[model samples]
Target: MKTDDAERPNMAVSIGRLMLKNPVITASGTFGYGEEFAPYLDLGRLGGMVLKGISEKPRPGNPPPRIAETPSGLLNAIGLENVGVDAFVTEKAPFLETLDTTVIANIFGESADEYARVAGKLTDVKCVDALEVNISCPNVNRGGMDFGADPEQAAEVTRAVKEATDLPVIVKLTPNVTDITAVARRVEAAGADALSLINTIRGMSVDVYTARPRLANVTGGLSGPAIRPVAVLMVWETVQAVSIPVIGMGGIMNARDALEFLIAGARAVEVGTANFVNPAAVLDIIDGIERHLGDAGVDDINDIIGTLDCRRK
Candidate 1:
């Protein structure tokens, strides 16, 4: 028998002023505008959905052989292919505005100016509740990983996006840097409403038999179960570094994976690659979280956030 609503856990959480009915949000690139997975999930039931990375102009993405499956994870060099911001406004906005869930646009650019331009375009879109600035994209002006790997450039991009829109800003940080907290603290100082991290770990694989790279780009972002521990550690570190809420994501494949992040101090979590393996994985995560909370006599999910005990354990 299903428990009454009053008896179940309260799953709501807030990222700045953006209130999510629950803490499970589908990661940017993997969710693909939210419409693609409609057949598999009741999109409205999710706390939020982040559309694929979008730019000022439509992108053709990276070359073929862009995806490779490892024993514990997936690697991809998909170069932010999307239908551009204008198309999103004219084509997808109508359908998106009708959904009940929070809609977050994941915007990226080659430069700080470009990031501002893309953000400016989505600012007026009624359906977009917030802007998730993806700093992981290459900085064509400097080089790949320039903005994300450097503290100053990351802060500049965050400020640019913040000035471009009135919507709340969530800056997504990359994990390739030696000091992630340096970048996170800088972005927070630049006025980012919230933070999400760590973007896929930098990785690659060689086709031993063919004597070639597995991906067309020779390297790609690593995601899935392999990076969960790293992600949790980063989230824990960043949370202590900044006063803003942290949205955790990396290898969250199930309830426990998501729980690790929450207990480590993430206000919420985003599910990535797992969507490719199971379309309804996010929904299952939501149910599982509620079940775990219920079993432990937790009435409010917020009670579990930042509850990590590091006292000589």
Candidate 2:
């Protein structure tokens, strides 16, 4: 039997300085600016919403056929299409201010200085709760994946952004690396308040008949159910490597998947590709987590985080 709404377990969790009512957050890019999904569900019910990646200036993104479907995942080369930071503060921030959920601004830049500049602009925005530095965008020509791949460069970027803003800075890490823990430790040393991992792995698809790439960019970030296991492992490893909170994401499609990340040691989980398949997936995940807690007689969601038994026989 399921517990009633009043009897459900407490789902609140914290990410660095930002406190969430629950642990389910909508990953950046997938949820747009939050206005698009307003009609489908109640935005206030969510733990948090990470808007699309924003740059100091507007980007048109890649050409047509920016997205392609895979067996159990998606390849996207949409770039970081956004209206720029100035417009976001003036136009988008107002609408986000009206919402009850925490609004985290995801910012990216081509250079370390540029990252600071963009973070500086967001500091005055009362609506923005925190800043999620997107240094893992594989589709961009420069600055995205490169900063995330090297420990020195990753620390430089994180330091620049932290120096520019008072908001909690969460560094989003890329999995397309030899050791993700190396990068996570670097960012943590640079004063990052939190970390969100396994940002899409680099992948590609080709049309067998045409002998051409499926995505316009030739390669794109791979997301969806295909990356869950990898994400779980990365999250587990990263949690052991750093003291800051880790927000795990990358192929989370249901409550079970979200629970896996939390159990592996993620303080919170983000729903990325799952949003495209079902707009209400985040809500379902939250409900499922509540039920899991109640059935197990768990009083708090934090009790299960990083509770994996590692005792060797």
TM-score, each model? 0.97, 0.97
Per-residue accuracy of model 1 over 1-313 as CA lDDT, tens digit each: 6789989899999998999999999999898888899899899999899999888889888779888998799988888888999998998889898899999999888889999998999998999999998887531233236788999999999999889899999999999989899999999999999999988888889999999999888888899999888999999999999999999999999999999999999999999988999999998999999999999999999999999999995
lDDT of 2 by residue, 37-140 (tens): 99999999999999999999999999979999987999999989999999898888888889999989999999999999999999999889999999999999
Model 2: per-residue Cα lDDT at residue 198:
83
Q: How accurate is candidate 2 locally (lDDT)?
A: 0.94
RMSD of 2: 1.4
Candidate 2, TM-score vs. the true structure? 0.97
Query: CA RMSD for every model?
Result: 1.4, 1.4
List where candidate 2 sits over 4 angstroms from the true fold: 1-6
Residue 37's lDDT in candidate 2:
95
Who wins the lDDT comparison? 2
Runs in model 1 with CA error above 4 Å?
138-144
